[model samples]
Target: MMNHKKILGIVLLVAVSISGLFAAESANTENTVKKSTIIYTIKGNAEETYYTMMDKPIKALGYRLPDPRKHVNQVYKEQYGSTTLEVLSFMTIVNDKKVKPLLEIDPKLAGFNPFNLVIYKHQGKDETVISHLTADAIIEMLGITDQKVITEYRKQMEELDALVAKTFPSAVVSHGTYEGAVENAMMHYEITFDRPEDLDDYIDEIQEKVDDTFTEKGYIMAGFFDYKQGKPDLLPSYDAFWTFSLCHFPYSYTVFDNEGAMPEVAVFAPCTMYMYIKKDTNTLVIGMPRLANWNRFFTMNNSKRMDFLNKLDKDIPATFLEIGAIEVK
Candidate 1:
């Protein structure tokens, strides 16, 4: 019979080998966009055009642009002592019916359920730039492998594209590369709570506490998803789970409005912070993607960007501790 140590070594080697293969595949696809990222340029000042898009909505497009600007002007002042350009970003949530089935297939799909639209102009620029990451890029980055889901996602995105063209008749629309940034690594911070006398009540309390902490820390709670509540039939195996999309306005402005900042990085925006409990377990798990991944693949090692992300990576866990959640060892 094989010794226990030898068996453990073999399992470890296999896990590393699998991880290496996935990394290699990601490397091969870097900087190569499967779908064209469409950019629309209007012949006018950036603020005017940004408002136009904000006010105008093509209902036929099957989505509505939520009116929330991160206020980059103030963000810039706070971060860099002064502001240089105008920047605003918003999102369009596709019809819930259209996105529901996709989410039922896989909850991870929630990351792109409400696609983003960004409008901004760099200092000294004559025109505002409007852009969005391609549907193919969104699908690929989330690692969606279902052919049916991919086809449906592409179709819905195409509908949005048509609406943009119709809404901005005079604007110039062109394709560019923006597949997605490489997720070289992910940061996971989780806390497991002992099963309370009333499990449901405890989960709700925990949720409220986490949300409160995020808001107090200058983070925006953009969207909340109760995966278990929505998909009891599909997720029968899961005891209970949920994810909240959180965003820090200053952090968003830093990456979106700054010159040379890759607007495509917004794909990770309102970072999806997930909390869940596995079936038959009393443990509550919470975590979010590390902001550093933004530098790894998209921002290209910007010091300020890295600093902002690093702070988030550290502070989030500390806040969890403050709120009476224990970090998973």
Candidate 2:
């Protein structure tokens, strides 16, 4: 009983609705990029008041806060004679148990194993920002697939997150937005060397050389942690596992503390390079998060900052090769 024109109108209406639905779905997919970093903005500037309190709680979480670089902005202000940052600092913390299961699966997991928990505040701002990478980011970035280990690690992070919330009751939590995971998130390399009669002797000799070499090249040995020696029970299967927090004084100053630069990026600063030697194995593995991650995760768009990022990406591996290590893949 319906007219032909009416039937045609009904068909047109259905087609338009379907098209709109598809368009909406596409837009949502694009907008749903995964977040890789977390930011907590807490009111009040108590300076090192909160920073010093973390030591006890961090130890309770089976983690350690090594080489706490508090008042970094003050150091910048003193050396550079001026600065934009008011409270930019870092506490490179690591949990051995979190990396124990993942380390052998992918030695590169050690790259972010000893990561930074950064605190920053902008000049004239009353709030302090504490930030770090999400556990999801770590699992994805390392290309890890073991769900059991992943779940355990995430839970560990949740415990740490709870500590933050309880410590700063009014902190506003947020995430660092990005397009998603970057390609080749970590830089990994390995070197096969002769097995020595005493492993400690080899470690001592090589460590001294590594320290001297980086220092000569104007790099700061920000901090060092030895899991095999420091926490023997945590690494039951490894002969050696250690991480060095590497920092380029000038580069850090320019990107984080200098005028017109991003201070929040310090969350990834003092890049921790990890190295390990498995039990009775002659191969020594090395890995770290590539500097390229800084630009992609943080969307730092300045040309000068990009140059620093690119140069470090190239320089880090080059330095490893220079220090008698073979590049693995």
Candidate 3:
């Protein structure tokens, strides 16, 4: 969580220099994006009913929560014996058919194929906050330009936003202004590998190395999905495509578990990194929303969070390079 009154707080402080924003467009860029994150704060703690209440409606709207990291507060408490949050969830969501059209124009959209739908309740707080990055922010970050796809995507956003309000009528809805959002917010990378007779063999070997690398760096591969499974034709642009829901425990605990730490940033938790190989190409492409985004969206006023963000922003790409991947712009 970026900033929540009765609210969100997130981390540790170390002296570290932050990186430059990915693109320089923010300078001359008109602040056309009104909000980067949308928040819905209902009067009561909707912990128990959160899922059952919105499950059907979310799916009916073409979104699916393949993996909802629910009750994460408890998971943290077990590790540290206490947590500032009573409820914290990272619901990674996707609208396959709807996103299919956009993927054709911008494969980068897969960077957030399953963006986090965040919900949190600080301990003793009576209200639950549900939030996520706005569609405009996402579309802009990916540099999406197709009008038809853009219109349809925004329409879905309206539908989803309306559904959230309908599900929690008395909720107070608000959005975080996108005044200083960094353009091209995603970190893109690529790795060229020799074509092997059996791609599975390559996947098996590299996947093991990738897992080991992240683990050694104190990162958690919380979830993995081969989007190609059962839907090979779904993404004709790629011979194989997948994503990793990555998380770093110490970083999370620092920003979210402490008594006064911000937990609302949990909405961006378990960062999703997308990987794919375009048909007829031997290069493996990868992309993920940058940790710097958390800084931009939430302003990350505290140096502690800035430290963690800076560390990971540099470390993640280095870790990939250690495994033979190259940063692409």
Candidate 4:
């Protein structure tokens, strides 16, 4: 027979143990939502090294080094006021042959087809950083579950990493992954437009509308791609397909500059969006990878960031409507 006090003590001990267990479980859940990045830090001037790398061709890597955009000086200064920061948006489309199977399985991969890489440093800083999304991150974000496809993506990524290592032999390559709360990995917005008398004219009209809308909202139209003009054999089977890169510098600066926000988030920068018309169909389809994904994928709990992103998410679809796009319920 136990005393009343002893029984009470036992009950208290059990309650405490249960509480600790729940706390630990919550912590483990948070840890699994992290995202990883591969970072290369160079000791020389960022702009000088960036231009040198850009000028060099990467034929050995199966793609030519495309021209890099000078975003900091050209776009950011106009929006964020003048600053010494220098940022470059470097892109290179993987060999179409290499990504054919993946595309066959999922056409959405085209949104990220020409991979985006970023390099940045303030003029005064002695160190420059080169960063891009890891192949693992891309696969996860793309929601690819096929083990075979995942393996191939990893192989390609490793090859690209090896090349980067060779290019910056002396630079330090490090990794960073976000270990915070995870939210919806991908947010998609889509709308359908009635086919006009002239397809080309309609596309131009939509493009002009997107340009005007995003610009009005303090964003930059970083780049555009006419997929129909790409390799016919390896590309998607769309009758008329196109994609564009859009970036809001101030929004970008807030995320990249904040220590709380994972810098690796830039891997998804300059939002890659798509629009297309199906063969024999008069409907034009337009869509974008939602921008709020930044907070969700990175597990950013900051209320202010979430508020801004929420507004952006709404604004994007609103832009579509403003351009006479009908929401594809």
Candidate 5:
């Protein structure tokens, strides 16, 4: 009985080995030769096309440009004529613990309008181009013409320029200080312009008007900081105007304590002027954080401020990632 049992066990072990060999061969054959088929469709306007190519894949999918009438909208009557273009893009990675394929399509793309489409799989850091299509024909179907279209477009740009000018303006502030026995009060005014040429004329006219206003109030110009002009690499170019003043007081000692402490600090103020010109619809842009600081007095007071501002201004025109021009009504 013991001998018979040993023979049966040996036969069972051999059969298991043979089954394992056959399963391994089948897996190798399946992996060695495999094929797949994929299909895709493309759609969008010129603006959409620009974004699809330039911006990050994911971010571009969600962004939507404002309605052309509400904002600025520019159209060319001639094919491939000079036209403004804006592009925006961003990407996000999925890192959940589940085991999934290397690449997955975003469901948001199904509902939103995108100008172009590229469906490709990436194997090892390399991209495999599976399918692609351009939606240029869709843009042409809009049928934009040059005659009445160009005139209306210019009107929109003018309206947009006026709106921006009214929104942002240059101004000044007044502060009081105690310098020993003297109670001194100062007024700081700032003026900014869109173009460098506009700066000179605007400042000149403003200075004349301001001098007359302060003259009646017995306010004399104590010091003037010459227009320190420099464009930061990544900011807009605008002239900054700064001036200081000191008003005469009749009873300086009586206004202060006998301890030589000055008192009765009164701010005798006048004009806070800001002049801005819209040079061209295409030229105005505030691209960087530092550019926003150009008119900020706290940031502009440093000795290195002009250098930094100019460097930023010069670099901004190139650093602008997305830009658009629209005619506003």
Candidate 6:
């Protein structure tokens, strides 16, 4: 016959043992059901023969080198949700111009550009998919050649220059413009920056400088405008104004911020200023601004744009962990 205290102790021990057994069984079941992730690593090289056939002028121009380490690494991390699948591509030293021509010639070759696609099982039976493609790929698909593209680009750039001159005949002092090829037309300007923080002080300085040089010039500084903040590094606001001609334009004091993980290569963010000028008592529009991201130009129903986005999503994963070189066998 056991004492009452002994019986109570036995019961407590049995209860604890049973609880421990249940916990172990539950953990084992979870481990058995968890799905294993698969990573695919793909490798390939650009065709050297194709690049060799490029035109002399095109060959002479500096080529955009594909930095496998930075670009590939960054794209993998940014696009894919998991760092599991990795793609490593190499390019043979071929003429720069031939590369674009080769890609343009074949639509199927489009996937050769750095991109990623992800697929996973969802809702018991349904499959979910996502993709991403780099900006380089998008630009190539536009089928824009140097001659076809440069002509329109130069015209817009020149118009912008003329507008600046007409707006600030005296204060303009010295101005210069640079041209480059990006996803869209690119232009750079070097204007006078007298004061640092005080926009009012800068405007006053510009006005005084202009007035002293061109006494009778029809130029006056309009009030400043503020821009809504977007992606921190991509869009930075400084000071903007409307000219006496009623044109709205904004000039940024900060050049570019390169402190973050990714540096902004463009000299200036897309600055669209509306200028209303009086031409014989009627306001004539002068400047039509455009942004660097060409995708925004098309309507939502555009198939090309949709395809581009789809390809991008496929190549790039939705999460950071999915970024990495996968061994594609």
Best by lDDT: 2
TM-score of 3: 0.86
RMSD of each: 8.7, 5.5, 13.2, 6.9, 30.6, 26.6
Per-candidate Cα lDDT values, in order, are 0.65, 0.80, 0.79, 0.66, 0.26, 0.27
Whichever of 1 and 6 has more lDDT, that candidate is 1
- Candidate 1 residue pairs in backbone clash: none
lDDT of 6 by residue, 170-226 (tens): 321221111222243321112423344544554455445433332232212222221
Q: Which segments of model 3 are wrong by more than 4 Å?
A: 1-33
After TM-score superposition, the amount by which residue 76's alpha carbon in candidate 1 deviates from its true location, in angstroms, is 4.8
User: How many backbone clashes does every candidate have?
Assistant: 0, 0, 12, 2, 29, 47
Give the per-residue lDDT of model 3 (tens digit) for 1-329.
Answer: 44653232222111121212323344546655568789999877886666875588789989977677888888989998888887888888888778876777777777767888888988887899998888888787777778877787888788888888888888899888767446757887888998899787777787788888999988998888776774668778777887888999889887777756777677678888888888878888988888887777776757887898899988998888898888888
Superposed model 4: Cα runs more than 4 Å off: 1-35, 64-67, 71-81, 84-97, 122-124, 179-183, 193-198, 230-236, 254-265, 297-306, 324-329
How well does candidate 4 score on lDDT at residue 103?
57
* Comparison by TM-score, 1 against 6, better one: 1
Candidate 1 residue-pair clash tally = 0
RMSD value for candidate 1: 8.7
CA lDDT for candidate 2: 0.80
Residue 3 deviation, candidate 5, in Å? 70
Arrange candidates by lDDT, highest first: which order? 2, 3, 4, 1, 6, 5
> Alpha-carbon error at 192 in model 5, in Å?
11
Tell me the tens digit of each residue's lDDT in model 2 across 178-294.
Answer: 663357887778878888998888888778878888888889999998877655666767889888999998888879866576877877788888888888899888888888778
TM-score of each: 0.67, 0.86, 0.86, 0.73, 0.20, 0.18
Candidate 5: Cα lDDT at 249:
23
Worst 10 residues of 4 by lDDT: 181-190
Q: Model 1 — which ten-residue stretch has the worst lDDT?
A: 180-189
